[model samples]
Target: MFNKILVGIDRSLISKKVFEVALSFATATGANLMLVQVLSDREEDYPQLPAYSYYPMWDDQTVRIYQQQWEEYKKQGIEILNNLAQQATEAGIATEFTQMSGSPERSICQIAYTWNADLIIVGNRGLTGIKEMVLGSVSNYVTHHAPCSVLIVRDTELLPPQSTSE
Candidate 1:
């Protein structure tokens, strides 16, 4: 039985499935569900290039752009988390949401360790070959390295909800 359940959610359509699975498990066990969103700092991604730029006489344009983009990303992430939390709450489950900037896998594992989560729920885009090798799958990483158990919900095609015919 899980006492603490941590679910990784992005703003992608796949996250909705992850949320459903997490909510069902949380409801069944009455566990505290923690929703996490990870955002990477753009500056970290583009390191080799000059950290700043400017027009003719200015030299802070690039830094300013990076900061603006980072803030916008965080704002978008927060909105996604809020929407997920709202949905989970409406389903009669208690949920907490948090965001951090870094490697998604690292942040997720650390939070799982910190929360001592009994289980971790994640979504799989089914990335393989080159894509999987270059951009490691978070679910795969967690499954291999998490301190606790992990549940990976594969992205599957779902049938449309049955319409009640009058």
Candidate 2:
């Protein structure tokens, strides 16, 4: 029943499974697929600051360097999205893509709303407890906030072991 499907993608292990599921849906239903990748700048990705009490502002040169780095990061994200788009296209599915810079959860939900997507497909990292609290779960946020229906693909290997009756 889905006409427009938006898939949130990234360069993560779980993304492979997400793509497979989304692609299957798109191929089966002949739905238009839109793949989106958000280029986030997590604090852990940057270098740590020194032990100085007062933090100095970035100099003009430093600003330029950071800008250049962000540009490269965006380019890399575009490349990844393009590759995914190609795969979808090869499967005879109509596909488009976008690369955004922001929080993954917000970006994915915003795009799904703006694009009028009928469904959003995202991968859940299966983080729980303290880890989920600290890192925040993008799929969880999208499930709660997305305007349209959301499908969270969880990696089977990450799922907890099931109990078998004797």
Candidate 3:
């Protein structure tokens, strides 16, 4: 039985599924859950311009707009963590969460280590070969670097209907 479980979350289509899996485990094991979301700058949909130096090359108006959007992005991340943590708490599970900005791979592992988690539950986008090399996989990194056990949840929708779910 894991005493503490760390979960890495993002704004992926599989996020809800990943949360469901982690929540079930926490409920069953009575484990304290640490949910984390890393606000990656390399968003596939929304592009976050560099936030340093006030984007000196750009005009003040553009810099302000980007800064505001970035702030909103961070806020959304915190909201996601808060919502998940609230769900876990409602289930009587001791829960905590953090929203960080940086490399998702490293951030998840760093939190897992510092929180002394017994298990890490993360989602796999199943990127492979060239795509994996270019995009880098967070689950892959976390599985190899986590301080304790790692549970990777693949997107079940990507699997055959007859296959095991979650």
TM-score of 1: 0.81
Tens digits of per-residue lDDT, candidate 3, 53-132, equal 34357778777888898888788888888988888899999998888778998998898888999999999886778988
Comparing 1 and 3 on lDDT, the stronger one? 3
Candidate 2 per-residue lDDT, tens place, 3-69, comes to 9999998877898889899999998899999999887644234322333423466566666666777
Q: lDDT (CA) for every model shown? A: 0.82, 0.86, 0.85
How close is every model to the real structure, measured as TM-score?
0.81, 0.86, 0.88
Q: Write down the TM-score for model 2.
A: 0.86
Model 1 regions lying over 4 Å from their true place? 41-58, 157-166
Give the per-residue Cα lDDT of candidate 1 at 105: 88
* C-alpha lDDT (0 to 100) for residue 40 of candidate 1: 52
Candidate 2 displacement at residue 48 in angstroms: 7.9
Off by over 4 Å in 3: 50-56, 159-166
Give the Cα error of residue 4 in candidate 2, in Å. 0.3
Best to worst by TM-score, what's the order?
Answer: 3, 2, 1
Worst 10 residues of 1 by lDDT: 42-51
Q: In terms of lDDT, which candidate is stronger, 2 or 3? A: 2
